[model samples]
Target: MNNFVLLEYAAWGISALLGLWMLADLIYTDRTYSEEMLTSSQEGDIEDSLVIDPTQQGGQK
Candidate 1:
């Protein structure tokens, strides 16, 4: 096989390994944690904390 063909195979092999790893990690984490905990996020809390009144940034009209 040519160098290019061999490199292509290597790239595909690496990609397959990475995909498998992610899948396995997902399964392991799901089995190890609760659904609510897995899906829980602080996005709302973060958004609420960023309140910026326009008056605070500049002189009021």
Candidate 2:
């Protein structure tokens, strides 16, 4: 009987640990994805700004 009780507690502890681990992984994944999206958008903005207008260099010769 005592062994059964110990086994039950062990199972509960393992279950709780697995749940926490999964939650942590989900949060981390979401944060990483968001950062990557922000970085990519910022890069696009930089590229657009770098575009040059040849006509703006004062009428062509």
Candidate 3:
């Protein structure tokens, strides 16, 4: 019973440390998004152009 309790405590501690590390990384990371990066030719609808046929070559049988 004591061993199980210790293991559970250790697991919780590790999980908390990992969560804090991820939170810190997210807070410190610099991410930028710009509209100028996209070109006119890259702004087309893809769903209307994609064709899916399972019986076609390179597709699942």
After superposition on all CA atoms, what RMSD does each candidate show versus the true structure?
10.2, 15.4, 8.7
lDDT of each: 0.83, 0.75, 0.66
How much is 42 displaced in model 1, in angstroms? 3.2
Instruction: Estimate candidate 1's alpha-carbon lDDT, on a 0 to 1 scale.
Output: 0.83
- Tens-digit per-residue lDDT, 1-61, candidate 3: 6999999999999999999999887665523433453332344465644343435537655
Compose the digit string of candidate 1's lDDT tens values, residues 2-53: 9999999999999999999999999999999999988865555544633455
TM-score of each: 0.68, 0.53, 0.47
Q: What does the lDDT read for residue 6 in candidate 3? A: 96
lDDT agreement of model 2 with the native: 0.75
In model 1, the worst 10-residue window by lDDT is: 42-51
**lDDT winner, 1 or 2:** 1
How much is the lDDT of residue 49 in candidate 1? 38
**Candidate 2, clashing residue pairs?**
none
Give the top-scoring candidate (TM-score).
1
Residue-level lDDT tens digits of model 2 in 15-44: 999999999998998887876664553334
lDDT of 3 at 61: 53
